[model samples]
Target: MSSTQQPQPVLNCDDLLELIPAYAFGLASPKEQQQVESGLTTCPEATAQLADYRRMQDDLRESVPQIEPPPALEDRLMAAIAAEPPARRRMPQVHRAWWAAAAAVVALVFSNVYWISRSSSAPPKAPDTNSHPILVQGDSSFVLTSSREIRWVRLPSAQKNTDATAVLMWNVESEIGLLYVRGFPPLSAGKTFQLWLTMGDAKLSAGTFQVDETGSGALLFNVTAPIDEYTWARITEEPEQGSSEPGEAVVVVGEL
Candidate 1:
C-alpha cells in the first residue's frame, strides 16, 4: 500500500523571534519549545537573537558590584537574630512515633522534673516514685534564675582550650538553658565557638557564641525538648558560618 505524507511547515523568523526569549528563560510550552527549536535551525536571525539574550543576562549579573548592608540595618538584623531561639535537634532516620514514646517514658521515670515548687500556679505533684531530678546544688552564679529541675554540670577543659572551664544550667520543664564559660582564648579569625547537646544518637546545635578578651562568656539557649533527657554536652570550635556536625576542636566537655 502506498500513502502520501504531508510535510511539516517551516516556522518563519518573525514568529520565532517572539518565542525565542520565552524558550531561553524556560517559560515556553512544549509545543512552543519545539517550534522555536526547529525555527532556530533554519533562521540565523532567531539564533543570533537567542545568543544575544543569553549574553545580555550574563552581563547583567556580572556587572552588579558587591554592596555591604548599612550599619543600622545590620544592627537590627543582629538584634532580631539574637531574640530568636536555636532550632530543635533532629533524630535522623528515626520515626516520629518513637520520639513521642521515648519522651513519654522519660516523663514517667522522672515525674518531678518539671515541678516548679515555688510557682503558685504549679500543678499538683505527681507521685515521684523514682529518684529526684538534679536540683540546685550550690550557690553558683551559673544558674541566673531559680527554677525547678535545673541541671548544673561543670565542664572542664577539653583537648583544645586547656585553661577553659564552663558550667551549664538547664530547666527541664521550661526548656531554658544557660552556659557560663571562662578562661578561653579568643578564637582565630573566621573561627566560632558553638555549644552542642548530645541527645540519644543525635547531636544538636544549641547556638554559637563569642567570648571576651579574658575568655569569659555566657549564653542563654532554649530548646523545645526537655534538656535533662540529654546526657552530654560539648563546646567546640567551628567555622564562622557554622557546621552541621562537630569538629575536632573540643574546648569544654561535660556530662549532664
Candidate 2:
C-alpha cells in the first residue's frame, strides 16, 4: 500500500469532533489547518477534543447572534434568480447538461448545510467551567474572525519571512465586541499587516491587512466605544505609507 502508504483517514472522536468548527472559526484550510495540526500533535484524545471545541467557542462568544439576510432573504434570492430559464439559444449540447444539473443541486444543498452546520457549537466545558461572553444587543460592536491556517517563514529578522496567525476574539456585551482570528500569515511582495489598539497611550488604528495563499484574512471593525477600553493588542509591519507608531515587531501579541 505504498502509494504514499495510503491508510490515513481514521481520525475519530468523530474526526476530532469534526475539526472543531475549522478549529474555532479560524476556518482551517492551510492544508486543513495542517491536517488539524497534525491531528492535534498525535491526538491526546484529539487534544482533549480540541479543548472541548475551544470551550464551546468561549461559551458561544457569550451568546453570539446578529444573523441577517431575511429581508425575505433578498426577496427570495431575487425570486429565484428571476425564475431561471435564461441561457437560451436552444440546447447547444443541452448546455453541459443544463449546467451540470445546476451544479449538482448546489453541491447537494451545500453538503447538507455543511453537515447540518457541523454540530452547532456547545460542547467544551469542564476545566472548572466558567464563562461570560455575552453582549449581543443591537449587534455591531466589533467582530472579525478569520483563520484558515497559513504560515511560511524565512526568519532572520524577516526582511520578508512570511506571516499568519490571526486572533481578535472579543465580545464585550451590549457594550459590544467580538473579533476572532486564527493562524493567519501570507503576504509576499510589498507586505502589509497593521492592526493595533491600546488604551494607555491611546494608540487606536484598527485596520490594514494582507493575506492570501489560503491564509484568509477578514475585517469588521465598528466601535463607537466599549471594547473594554482596549488594553493592548498588536500586529505591525507596515509602511505602505502607514504608521503613526509601532513601526515593526510584535507580529502577534495578546491582552485585550
Candidate with best TM-score: 1
Model 1 bad stretches (over 4 Å): 1-148
Per-candidate TM-scores read 0.43, 0.21
lDDT of 2 by residue, 88-182 (tens): 12223433353233223322323221111113264222111233211122223222111111111111112223453544444333233323333
TM-score of 2: 0.21
Total residue pair clashes for candidate 2:
16
| Decoy 1 TM-score against native | 0.43
Q: What is each predicted model's overall lDDT from 0 to 1?
A: 0.66, 0.48
